[model samples]
Target: MDKALNKTQDRDLIKGFMKGNDRCFEVLLSKYKTKVFTTIYLIVKDRSIAEDLFQEVMIKVVRMIRSGKYNEEGKFLPWVVRIARNLAIDHFRKVQRNPIQHESEDYDIFNTIPRSEGSAEDKIISEENTRYIKELIQQLPDKQREVLIMRSYADLSFKEIASLTDVSINTALGRMRYALLNLKKLAQEKSVPQSYENKVQR
Candidate 1:
């Protein structure tokens, strides 16, 4: 579907739900459930907690739309994603479990390499390089790592990331710049494949 049309449909659905058409809400939920759930799971790293948070996010979305509190204009997905991110963080704070481990065949972070021409890059990965790269990402300072994950893993635009992170767009861009630079340097030090380093540079 065209992006603009998707937003228009979301607006229509929101309006329909506001007018008490519950089915509109179902359509919206069915469209967004997986992405929203994945956002939660990325932070909490527990399926059960992610499922609970997903329900909370849906309830909040429905209530906010009904009460006219959803003031994000036409950007429904990013708005809901922000809610999911926050709730996931709040839950993680409560449980304080092991580090997050993202596992998604479709939304895999490896598919997000800079030179990645979509799925073409997925076939080039080596397990050793993958582990090294993941470790390098973890070594980044918190702010840098956060920006990189949101941009690369969540596929958020810099504008959306800045809005969600409450920073200027330049700041978001800068963090991503530094994150990639750091990763490239780390990769070089670890002597990862030149192909991987090339992807980072790109």
Candidate 2:
């Protein structure tokens, strides 16, 4: 669907959900569950913890909406994303754990890559390249890595990312800029394929 249509649909769904329509909530969940889960997973890097957090985030969102605590003026996806990000950060703080750890069971980096219509072989090659790039992203400094993951995987605007990270817009932009530059340098150092370089540029 087009961006404008999607926004309209989301608004309608939110209205329905606010009116106690369980089906509308299900529709919203179907649309956003993957994005929400992936955002949490990218941060926590633990599938089990991420899954638990995802359920908690959803429950909180529903309760907030039902109690009229959620702002209807805000865009739904970004609002939910902000909640997910905050909760994931809170989890790390509570556990006194580093959130950037590289530990996951058979994680699929393909979800972070943009979809394209291509041959089976092309898709396979693209997935392999994205896996390598994901590792490169993981190697970045904490701030840079978090910014990159939020912008790239979660489809968050720099403004939203700045707010979430409690940094100025310029700082968020700087981190993303440095992330790309560092990733490109690493790709060159590792002699990754030209196709992968092209993907990074995109």
Best by lDDT: 2
| Model 2: how far residue 36 lies from native, Å | 1.8
Clashing pairs for model 2 are none
Judging by TM-score against the true structure, name the best candidate.
2
Model 1: worst 10 consecutive residues (lDDT sum): 109-118
Q: Model 2 TM-score?
A: 0.78
RMSD of 1: 6.1
Clashes of 1: 0
List model 2 lDDT by residue over 42-67, tens digit each: 77766778888999999999998889
Model 2: how far is 10 from its true place, Å? Answer: 2.4
RMSD of 2: 4.2
In order, the Cα lDDT scores of the candidates are 0.74, 0.80
Put down candidate 1 lDDT per residue, 3-73, tens digits, no spaces.
Answer: 44345587787887898978778778878776676556545545556678889999998888888998746
Residue 129 of model 1 has an lDDT of 65
